[model samples]
Target chain A: MKKIIIASTSAMYGGKYLEYLQPVLQEHFKDCSSLVFIPYARPGGITHEAYTAKVAETFTAIGINVKGLHEFDNPAQAVLDAEALFTGGGNTFLLVNELYNTGVMQALEKAVHAGTPYLGSSAGSNICGLTMQTTNDMPIIYPPSFKTLGVVPFNINPHYLDPVEGSTHMGETRETRIREFHVFHRQPVVGLREGSWLEVKGSAIVLGGDRHARIFRQGQEPEEVAPGADLSGLK
Target chain B: MKKIIIASTSAMYGGKYLEYLQPVLQEHFKDCSSLVFIPYARPGGITHEAYTAKVAETFTAIGINVKGLHEFDNPAQAVLDAEALFTGGGNTFLLVNELYNTGVMQALEKAVHAGTPYLGSSAGSNICGLTMQTTNDMPIIYPPSFKTLGVVPFNINPHYLDPVEGSTHMGETRETRIREFHVFHRQPVVGLREGSWLEVKGSAIVLGGDRHARIFRQGQEPEEVAPGADLSGLK
Candidate 1:
């Protein structure tokens, strides 16, 4: 059975790194002593070593060891052999580009399907969907394809924000962007707000956290879904 | 020689479409009667005809006739023979995709280089830069390539927003996103705030409108450029 925890963000407002999800992660990786971290996203352009060390510090508190995927000579083998996997947040374009370039996208998908515990946040969680077309990140780099792991049937708009009331910004709101996405794609999208996640075990997928997620379907009005609701039937 | 008006947005907060740039555009297109409108970006997923109609209504107020590129038999030819050109705001990915798909990307670039009075807003303004990598729009679609019209030497981050004071949103700020882009790209980026624009005439590119623009260069701190400042030196 596959076990995955896809979160909208790694941290919350004024919260320490991964502090909000400490309890959930402890339970998710309880059986694993060490996990492989994919730090290719390199948030804020931080180096691979620096990003890995940050993750290591977070996992140390949970009694789990951490190893960056970049440290391995063969990243695919590292992912397949790891007891658990965690991909942190950053630019989705950079994350997908690195995943495909390193030839570990398939291996990670296979490892997760074979039941290795997996955790993803933000850009990491966005790749667990059908395609990265609905991401809110800038296209800092071009990837070979928009196709992703597709571990989840629908797409995810991580760190999804609501329209500000009486705002003067002319930029498209999150809902308007997702609605435009439906014009080109039929894949369902979940507007995953911060502090929320989707817990997938085997064929079951449930929304986790304290807030509600907005669900968008093609050619239909968006619907709000509360936490703990089964989202496995999204497709 | 290139005569271009690259604006952060077509409309201001609580303003009508293209209302903010009415006077600038009136002067920019004073010599021409009919102008070609590229409605490929299609804000809110509106039809090309509908989007063009909205722009037409605005241009009509300035004594200029409007025609959508989609109405032509050969889009590329229409661009080459256009008296004036305007690409309205919307999804950058979709706009770039259509520009390349219909073979108008090169044609429009050539026309602009030949001194066609051209106006662009938001995504439209983004392409006037070296690439569309700095746009804040969602990746609702994937273009064949990120390369765009290089009429300007630097990339433009349209609708540039400053970090909100004391906000707890976990999402990366506009400055952080642009800084990350610098890791892989050396091109300078101009964070064009709403109501601001870049006026390019021949070899001189000057910042226009009421506000200041943020300029980001690799390995250096961002500098704020005031209105009417010459930006042609950015490279």
Candidate 2:
């Protein structure tokens, strides 16, 4: 019975970090007294301790204690032993690099599949997909592979954006980029817009939050999925 | 002398492909009767022959014949024997993949460095830098490496855009993305706007076109280099 919350972002427009998701998180993480946080993503190049403390300040408000995985001697064991787990957003390349280098990727995947309550935002949520091929982040560093935890059936395009009308920029749009991904990859990609999230319980995956997500399947027209839509069929 | 034109894009806001730069190109390739074009990037997933023909259409107007490297039996030899060269824009990952897979990366770099008049746009221009770390394109495919030609001293962010004034998007801005790149790499990055280009004549790299280019150096404030500004000091 896998339970997970894969969010598009940690913060939304003019909102405090994780503020909008706290109610859902409080209910989702009700069974756990403390959670092991994976701060390897290091948004803005912040230190592990600092990022963890930032997360701790939020979780503490919900009567849940938080500890960073880096605080532990063995990160693999930390994931295996965590009552609940949460990974914050940052550079996906950096996150994947550390996950592979520290040999914690397998442990984290196994623990989550074995029914640990897991919450991931942005880069954290991206690792739940088939691959990081759809990520919108820069390639500041290369990981051993673009392979990620296959907790979900398809790849996720977190912070998915729509093309601006009448833009003069010649760069590929978010939609165009995804189309290019399909030229080489067959995996379906879920363009999860900000304020949107996927709630997973066993084989059931539902779209939550205020907006709609765009589903892109190979050789098929992209379709808009409204909030509360069941996406388990995609798997 | 290494004579090259690394442009942000092949076309401007409302212009045809290579239209605005025709005069400059005519002068740049004055003595060359024909050019070897690398269509490895394949903008919009176009075929090699089709993309080459498109370039041929543009060059034919300038009284220069165009031949795609793909048409040659040996791409490396074609590059070495060519009087001039051009690489078009598309997905950088795809271009880099073909460059490494076909063993043309080294040959192309060698030819360009050995005084060949070369032209690059978008993804092609990005390869002229130290690495493809600053490219605005999505990672549609994995390349053997991010290492590029280093024809120029630093990295380039082609089709560079500014932060929208009142946007609610949560994705990192172009400037923020470049700043993030500086966290892991010390190489300076030039945010080349769509209409801007770098005119490389020997060691003198001058910013060209109407707009100012944004320069990002690690641990230093970003600076705006006006059009026609000599960037030889950077090298």
DockQ each:
0.87, 0.75
lDDT of 2 by residue, B1-235 (tens): 8999999999987989999899889999999999999999887678999999999999999999999999999888899899999999999989999999988999989998899999999999999999998887777788989999999999999999999999998888989888889899998999999888999989999998999999999989999989999998884
Give the TM-score of each candidate.
0.99, 0.98
In model 2 chain A, the worst 10-residue window by lDDT is A167-176
Model 1 chain B — which ten-residue stretch has the worst lDDT?
B162-171
Regions of model 2 farther than 4 Å from truth: none
Expressed as tens digits, the lDDT of each residue in A103-191 for candidate 1 is 99999899999999999999999999999988888999999999999999999999999997777888888899999999989989999
Q: What's the chain B TM-score of candidate 2?
A: 0.98
Among these predicted structures, which one has the highest lDDT?
Answer: 1
lDDT, candidate 1, B1-235, per-residue tens: 8999999998888888888788898899999999999999998899999999999999999899999999999999999999999999999999999999999999999999999999999999999989999999888887999999999988999999999788778999999999999999999999999999999999999999989999999999999999999998999
Report, for every candidate in turn, its global Cα lDDT versus the true structure.
0.94, 0.92
